[model samples]
Target: MQIYWTKINKIIEETPEVKTFLLDCPEGYTWEEGAHIHLALEGFNAGDKPNRRLIRHMSISTLPNENSIGITTRIKEQCSEFKAILRNLDVGDEMAIFKTHSNVPLKREDKNVYLLSSGVGLATFRPLVLDYFERADNVNKIHSLNVDSSKDFLFTNIFESAPDKKFASQFVDNRKDYYEEVKNLAADKDGLFYVVGSDEFLVQNIEVLLEQGIKPDQIMLDKHARQLPEFLSSDLSI
Candidate 1:
């Protein structure tokens, strides 16, 4: 992987616990939709040792435009390094980034596209969504389902106004039945589905989709955690 030093341009808080960082990339740097880059955090205190933290597999949260790119991250703990570094990041500070890469090819000419995401999984789908909006003759139908644990949903206005067939957001609390709500939503359409989230999140939703009659081939999932046994079942084979 090729590494480059980029400057942090700006950081915006999308929610109470989430922030989006805008980076100024080097001239002529380009990346495709769904690609991910690595960020190296050195000189950070990791327990007793002065260690380096490398965050690979971070998704590009926006299109590279005017020599800049964006990444959105969620704050896990109050004292976490990820939160500390991001909160204190400045405009001129330099950060190391590896070249972008992805196994998924997001170039779809189909008029219908469904984007389903939870938490920071939206970052993986941001570039593709932006490209669809930027094209001059783009008349494709885009449907986005953003699932969150509460009412403070991220990017609500942006996705609501985004050009598409439909846009919806569902907030689930642990006390509520999340599976039933998601199952009802997934049954509304039979189109290309892109699912991204934690492994448990993906597994639960994917099973709900399949139980509701969505074909395995029609559903594509990208999760941060390792694959679960449910996802590895033979029934998923085409």
Candidate 2:
């Protein structure tokens, strides 16, 4: 696979535990909204096989036209080794990106789109929202629901409600309210649901959506095809 090394342009701390690393987009590197890449640390390519510990699957939080590649993530006090190393890296530090792909590209079907996420998982949908606002041709409307227990919501500037833009955004801090809103959104069975978060989060969202009559095909996830059956089997009986 072709690997492109790029330097960090800047870092924006969205919250105490969340950060957005803006990397210099390499020439000829282009991706659609909701794309993700394998971000490798400095020594990832030193050995024959890539070191799994040094590599992370991160969402490309920016669209191609935005000029910079954004990797937004949360690094709490007790995090993994990869995230700890990432948090210490300063601007101008170089990292390699490869195996870029997107499973949740914007699907404009003249239907309202709902984005449900937890904490920093909303980073995966930043580009999708931007893409819809920039060119909302096929989409009818867009609504975003994010639950961050920290209450220090990220991307508030971009997630604001815009009647003219036919977009709305809501932030909640608790799971009880978050699921209530999800159920309300799921009432619109024709709407498209895009979910991003931990496996548990995805399963919870899928279960709620399915229980509310949303079909498996109507929901979109950031997981791979091989990993989807597990999440999509929420309605199946053992």
Best candidate, lDDT = 2
lDDT of 2: 0.93
lDDT string, candidate 1, 97-153, tens digits:
775675433646553556777767777877766676666243346666666775567
Candidate 2 off by > 4 Å: 234-238
TM-score for candidate 2: 0.97
By summed lDDT, the worst window of 10 consecutive residues in model 2 runs over: 229-238
Listed per candidate, the RMSD to the true structure in angstroms reads 4.3, 1.3
lDDT of 1 at 132: 65
Per-residue lDDT of 93 in model 2: 99
